[model samples]
Target: MRNFYSALILLLCFVACKETTSGKKEAEQHVMPSAQAVDTLLKEEKKPAPKTFRTFENLADTTFVRLADFSDGFAYDLRYATKNNFLKEKVYDCAECYTRVKTAKALLKANEEFKKSGVRIKFFDCYRPNSVQYKMWKIVPNPQYVANPKKGSIHNKGGAVDITLETLEGEELDMGTDFDFFGKRAYHDNFDLPEKVLANRKLLKETMEKHGFWSIRTEWWHYNLKAGSNDKVANFKWNCNQ
Candidate 1:
């Protein structure tokens, strides 16, 4: 009788311990956080909030000028206007081309150092309107070379720039082809290009990148501000001439 009672007590203890272990295992499985869920939460926290400011229309009463006119440190020989082998039409209200202005100032300061090397910065295109961007897109919808007109282009926002290298006397270097050329030749790293052209492209790219500008891989002449997207849109109509 004593042996029987001890055996029964041991059995009961074993069953209770097994049930408790199973319950704990089940709770652990249900309460664990998924790796994906944690990653998603981290990403959500990293996103920046959008900003709002006064519209361009609200600043209509204030005077504005093209960045080029505001400072003489940089030089502008609008390539399109000349009877050269390049496009020749000005599509921006010069005064409202803030990106160009900012770029010019940076280049001017950089040129002081580049002048020792007999190199200078030149402008090919600046401050394009949405209308002209659409026209260009119709000509070539190359995503690597040109921005889509259906979407708001950085140029339309007055923050995109097209530029090249030139001699102090204003002679353009061989950058493979004209600005907006949609071909492999325009690539900064094209192996078939002459060494001089490649070197010139590298100089322009490095200098611009140093001053907070980034280059498009497909077009050597194209460089937009690294932080240009931060600029808010203005509803103020451009002053055709400033």
Candidate 2:
């Protein structure tokens, strides 16, 4: 009877130890995943929010601002920033589009109108600094082509832009000649071209005019804001590192 009781006690002890081990393992399985999930949530919470475009509210019309910061709706080529321009030299350290607040406003409006026609404005240049004008003058040295830096053209005043229209897919519309083409083919008055090119030029001209921009007779791509012409010429340069 003593041996039988001893054996029974041993069996009980074994079952209790097995149950305890199984319970510990179950707890570990649940706790490990819960801890990992909590860690993932914390990482997600620490991440920064996505960036967004800035607004022009409360900013003075004369204030210079980067166009990309205001809206991502427009396109940029910035030819002078590269060697693709008439100067055939990379004049800018980096590509950027800056304009006076009023000019940006007019461009935004004009772009919106262009979008309605299934196209958008692509900028070749905008708000050229007075210093850059001087560089361009040294390269070209032609009053008819490069504006005299000393006299300060409308571009130096942060009001002028060289632009073209492109389809929503980014295919450039034919405007007869390339940008900075110093010839009759680029003339706004030249109508002896294909119907499509003429229509494209007409669309760009009429829309820009409606938004208080006036085109020069010689260059099909150049447009100056009528109000922006009075703004003082600026030599403010954008930071290329940014």
Candidate 3:
């Protein structure tokens, strides 16, 4: 009887030990999954945002569109809206870059090509109302400085843009001169500039030309879209508070 009881107790002890080990392993499995699931959810929350672009199919080629609504990649430092420009007065109620659909399309393609070289277009000016052109004419009245408001500038026609190259990191390229710097230093034909400046201007000019844009001999920063220059000059304005 004593042997029998000792054997029975040993058996019970072995079963209890086995059960404890199994229970521990099962608890570990449950705890591990919960922790891993929480970690995965946190990672998902930190993922990068999806890219967004506006649809342009419905818009007419001549229709003026806000460039920002189409793509967020381009940069803007609209000069006429502030006193920093040669005008020395804020002629616009706000700074907004608008262009015709065709011009915008060409610009978008040019920007894509620019991105391949780690650069992008930064606009100094865009579609200007004839009224704003008149204001600029009032300041300088020179046909050379401000395009005659009566004839209407390519800007008023939504065909031209004054722009420069900037890196993806927002550093401006050495284009030798600032936008609207009415001097020989700002001319595309000027070759006396630093090599880097010439190269930068070359890249800008070539890429724009390939995209149906033509640069003026006098201004390195100005580009006119061939298809849009014939469009009617517009006096319509954009909403400033929007």
Candidate 4:
């Protein structure tokens, strides 16, 4: 009778242990993450947040010139070489010209207000080719007004703009020297300028600033649209006509 009881107890103990092991195995299988869930987690980890505003890279080439629809008579001198001293002899389409089309339209609308005041906007440089920019960079590697090509320029991206104020008669404003002049006369806060020139610069800066444009401290004529990300670099092919 004693032997029989001992054997029965041993058998019960083995069954309980087996059942515990089976329960543990089932629990582990149930708790393990699914392959689909793991893949989804990895995908989420890789994904970046969407930008709040549209960037230049997100835009098509055709979208860059949409501002032209809003205004007429604003000639693109880079489309054809003219005797304009401010223009580079080699014409090339500007990437920034397209990127800032919306800002350009705003500038045109603001020009209408300026026109009421007998003023017009004159562009010196727009989209510059990497080649031309490279040339300029070589000439003046560390210009106060211009950016280095090694670092990439707003002109390269079709986003940097250099312009000045003019009169309806085509006479340039006293905002100081000719455009692209590498001197203090082009400096934004050069107090040596005539009061009228200073006023004109102030007007241009204020108008551009109001329309989401920011000017460089070194060049009164240089302004960038604050619309796109700074990281966006454009290597768009330039057409002879911009």
User: How does residue 92 of candidate 4 score in lDDT?
Assistant: 43
Worst 10 residues of 3 by lDDT: 29-38
lDDT measured at residue 34 in model 4 versus the true structure, 0 to 100: 92
| CA lDDT of each prediction against the hidden true structure | 0.64, 0.93, 0.93, 0.65
Off by over 4 Å in 1: 1-65, 77-104, 135-146, 232-237
Q: Which is superior by TM-score, 3 or 4?
A: 3
Q: What lDDT score goes with residue 225 in model 2?
A: 97
Candidate 1 residue lDDT tens string, 1-242:
99999999999999999999999998987897689988999999998874443233333322223654444434565543443423343433342344434444555566676677787766766666677666556655776545687775666666667777778887878877877677889877687888888787878888778877787777788878766655543333555543
* Candidate 3 C-alpha lDDT tens digits along 1-242: 99999999999999999999999999998777687798999999999887677879888888889999999989999988899998889999999999999999999999999999999999999999999999889899999888889999889999999999999999999999888888999988899999999999999999999999998999999999999877898998999999
In terms of lDDT, model 1 sits at 0.64
Instruction: Give me the displacement of residue 227 in model 1, in angstroms.
Output: 1.3
Q: Model 1 Cα displacement at 196 (Å)?
A: 1.2
TM-score of each: 0.59, 0.80, 0.84, 0.60
Q: What is the lDDT of residue 106 in candidate 1?
A: 58
Displacement of residue 63 (Cα, Å) in model 3 is 1.3
Expressed as tens digits, the lDDT of each residue in 20-84 for candidate 4 is 99999999989998999999999999999853533345544324553344454343433213344
